[model samples]
Target: MRLTRCSGRSCLSWLSTIALTLLAGSTLTAGIALDLQDPNSIKAAASTCAYNLLTFYTGNNTGDVPGNLPAPYYWWEAGAMFGILIDYYYYTNDSQYNDLVTQGMLWQVGPDDDYMTPNQTKTEGNDDQGFWGMAAMSAAEQKYPDPPSGKPQWLALAQAVFNDQASRWDNQYCNGGLRWQIFTFNTGYDYKNSISNGCFFNLGARLALYTGNDTYAQWAEKTFNWTQAVSLMDQNYHFYDGAHTTLNCSDINRVQWTYNAGVFLLGASVMYNYVKCSNVEESDTRTDSLLSQTNGSALWLERVEGILNASSIFFATNPPNVMYEVACEPPNTCDTDNYSFKAYLARWLVASIKYAPFIQTTVMPWVQASATAAALQCSGGTNGQMCGMKWTQGSTWDGTQGVGQQMGALSVIQANLIDQVSVPVTNKTGGTSQGNAGAGGGGGVSTSDPALSQNAITQGSRAGAGVLTCLVLISVIGCSWWMIA
Candidate 1:
């Protein structure tokens, strides 16, 4: 999606074609051919992602949580991986990524990352523990067994990740809940963000379902109950900003982040399928009120749907030719100053939109490409536009920005998978909000903080790094019906 605008033509030639084919007053196509997947784009995005994940091993992973982007941190990247794999399948359903997942599963030892290691402390502060673990677990256990060879190695990785996260449940928070992390980005370094904790809980729920383990599911129930009581957002949503970060509770604001919010929904939807009465653990009678057998927590799913609904703003208001935004309704343009957030939000949002089509359906060619172009405009290379991100005013082209932009590459292709499914996820919604969302020019003003009023990132540094050029791993396996466990 972000790789090739002309398939093989040079960027200048391609840009010329764009100009000739599109005019300012010319209405953009409302519906794209659902078969919009591009093999070159898929390969490019997957390859770049491998490098981005590799950065997590070093101290280079950006944003606030420094050393916790890749392995040895968490599995919140399940959606991230889904973004990549969906692109792979859509473009050319290659089984090679599954091979990588299998290889990743085989290497699920401490040396591989932090698979065998326990949390340095009893709290869930172990960043990569659940993030990568969940992605690898889901791919290996459920997804990778498509060829029908019972994957013992993948099963073991899933089991191992479950064990490690479970060990962290000494479980005392500001209230009676599982303490996920004792750290914060804005202020002091000891608080848990709901995004991370929700990811952790969701991972646990996924593992329980994978192994058919009552203990794991029981634990998942407890965490969800705690989340409902504490992190429930806007009275109607299930997401939370943080457990309780600031005095005014303004810090833990709306459940706005797209990838972050998807964790909760994926967990609930996946967990809802398997949460039958099990005598796994009876330590406390406090049941996970959201997981029921006969009927799902209507409110819980509705909240999840509502959260996805907020994400559609990416499509509604933003220029159909632009990429994604960091916040759905950011106070100002600076909120999207971070390049990677712009990239991954679109990727993750697309993953949720497509996978949970009940939440969002329909394929808008112009909308999808707008996001890819905005991101490519940021990246700006033969692959994309090869531009850098606008992360703070002075700091330019850091590792964090690169990490985030790769997410866009991931989403551009992921959405291509379900593009053929013509029905809109919800007929009640339209892409009206995306009209003014992702405008060009880095950012001229700051809606949240005047301090974020940095100018836009220039197009010169749209330097595509070495990894962006080629991702060679690919084994085309026919897409068959699900080989359910």
Candidate 2:
């Protein structure tokens, strides 16, 4: 999301999210949702946190700014959309992520949706999935169980994504880059998009692997090469679409935002890895170049950090902690949704603490959610809500339909825990453990997010719900498959 500079063209719209709700008659075989006539704050409410989170997460709706809805409202749901789910799958060995993602895939309708069907409501060129699609394919392959897919729902979503891109047939411009915008709102049409092209490059590489089609892989490589050659400048600093030199457009290529450049770093790093996997010789070449490329990416991250640090300085002018000039966008085509900015930037800063070759450690542990319901609830808010909600524009912590900010923060924490062995985990006996082990470690496979929470109140009652959810999900999956078969 950025400042409004488009030409009144919006690809994704409110109707898109609502459309999925309209057409998706399918239910989660995991059955995390209940028809229960009443709400249980402790059991049901806690479950609501994960259930809604999983749903948004699975949709692969996080992180990379959607041109349509640019608010922090969906930030957590989107970041955890990929970053959290992938790490947790390996850390906790739980089915929650699967349920979240697979069910989400089934709910596709727009650009990032697994189901990328033609919609008259959408712009002609706005059909790419960006990083979200790449992450979804990765999650499905890594975590999905065998047979009947543990939930046959994913198949439809996957097919939809593939069809969406193939139908675009946008194999022109900067060598197969996706034609991102016919015209971004107040902003003019951003032709030859760098972000979505990189995503397609990644997806194409995966398709080449999964379908064993070298053509797609080659396309991925070529696109990557074009993007790199064209997009990179000033020793690998990223641009919105590509370098200004390679562009025919006037101003569109001139303006490069913090995240726009950072995404290229993220994209290049991931794409190079996939390219290497396709061949041993390529692997070695990529491995040799990986550090340099990652360094470039780190540089972009550093730049982003600089801007955020300055903004936080400005916000600090307030006695308490007021969000001023936070450099967030509104949920319009041109500007990003501001709510998402806070959510995403927070996670990005945390990520820098873990990765990024250049280390700048700033671990703000105070932000962690409280262990108890009362403690977790914001102090000043009435009837159980976050105090921050009052200050935060557009959206609340109490509303249970699901909050993107929570999903974003939760995903970042989960990813942090899973990536590192240092995060403490507990066991059934209620003792301390480490590196995804002991009684709380879910029988040693190590892929669940909930098991790693260090605090007692958060981790205390989750195991039962997790184990039951898994078993019931497995059963439902079996039955769902049998019925389909």
Candidate 3:
């Protein structure tokens, strides 16, 4: 159903379409029929996409799991795929993919187990290492099942990656920022990119959260400030592509990607939750500033919230709510590398809601609408289902199948585990069931990161008058939840 502007009747029509989509059973694997609010449905959808990864990957042993892409494993994309699998472990607590995750990460560690120089090399940029490092850190945070006897522990691998990335922090260009490429021979070695620094900040925040280490928190703050100081991230929290050192690192790439926003948001959220003040002391005066504000409002919270609002508001102006590739997808010129961009957005959106529940009222509607459109845009593929790049309602798949599309759709579906809305219901006995109370909007409940515990709603309640601004943008029509196919 096409949106005819934001009128009440049009909102009702959209709700009707969503209602029809949800009535289709949650098990439908071909296209839609995915209940984004149900854990079982999320697990099924994630399993389907994860199983599909093997088709593109070539490896027999555990270490070779994320092996070379049939054409040599692209570091960034493959790293993200590894992360999706790890997130699945965290979301569902099913250790089925533990070995794969462990082996895949172990395979990347150098002889010293530090990822400074991974076994494989296309271009060993700080950004590339940071991607893999973030994945390893995610595993460490989860204590991912385990590889095998004598293998490096997930924590050790992550620390090694952090140690290596920190060593490359050059103060020459922008006081402190990691270069895009580490190898002098690489073309962009002199460029300081958002991904590199964002990865560093993310890794530091996660490490700080998991290990309770203040150094990691310090690194997180410093890296975020460097990105801001250097103008890689603007005041509105709009992240530019990269800045070159040739011009005193003053030239901005002017391109915006969702993943950049995702990483920084998740990183800041992590810091906000774990690091109360710059000093991780129990009696620090600065800690008072943290508890007084809302969740995710301390440290990098303000900036994180800024980026989240800016991205959702400005990224996709045409469809109003859908998040699009601002630089590439608009022109139908997004290449394979751009395919997986939205997946990161999906990942961090859920992360933001998890660590910073106060933002749930702000981000829930956008998440619901986008995830619904993604599921609706899926088409039957050789392996059950494939989602397209453009996720407008009722749009057909572009006949494209690769890691990017698979990851993008998988991330969105997986995020449902965290951001799902339950509608209020009445039982046969005339009692109101405390179920999810939303279809067009969320329950406005905020939960802690799944890494904390399986069931921990840190804070959840009705959106008060203060959130009217967020509520204004959401079309609340008393909609019902659905699992569309």
**Deviation from native of the Cα of residue 155 in model 1, angstroms:** 3.2
* Candidate 3 least-lDDT 10 residues: 463-472
Ranking of candidates on TM-score, top first: 3, 1, 2
lDDT over C-alpha atoms for residue 125 of model 2? 36
lDDT of all the models against the reference?
Answer: 0.40, 0.33, 0.62
RMSD of each: 16.8, 18.7, 12.3
**lDDT string, candidate 2, 191-272, tens digits:** 6565546445545544433332333434455555556555432233434434221354322454333334333333333333
Candidate 3, 1-485: lDDT as tens digits: 45456668778666545543443334234475677657787677677766675567665445554434545346666667788888877776677767766666667666766564444455777777777777766665544555565776665565666666666777676666888987788889889999989988887777555544444555677788889988998889999889888887788998888889889988877666553322223343343222333443343556667887777743343344566667776577888888888888887788666555667776655666566666655674764466777765344566667778777777777776774432111121122111111110112111221221122221131111011001111222121122221
Off by over 4 Å in 2: 1-101, 109-114, 118-128, 145-176, 181-190, 205-217, 228-234, 241-247, 253-262, 272-338, 341-402, 420-485
TM-score of 2: 0.46
lDDT of 3 at 258: 88
Candidate number with greatest lDDT: 3
lDDT of 3: 0.62
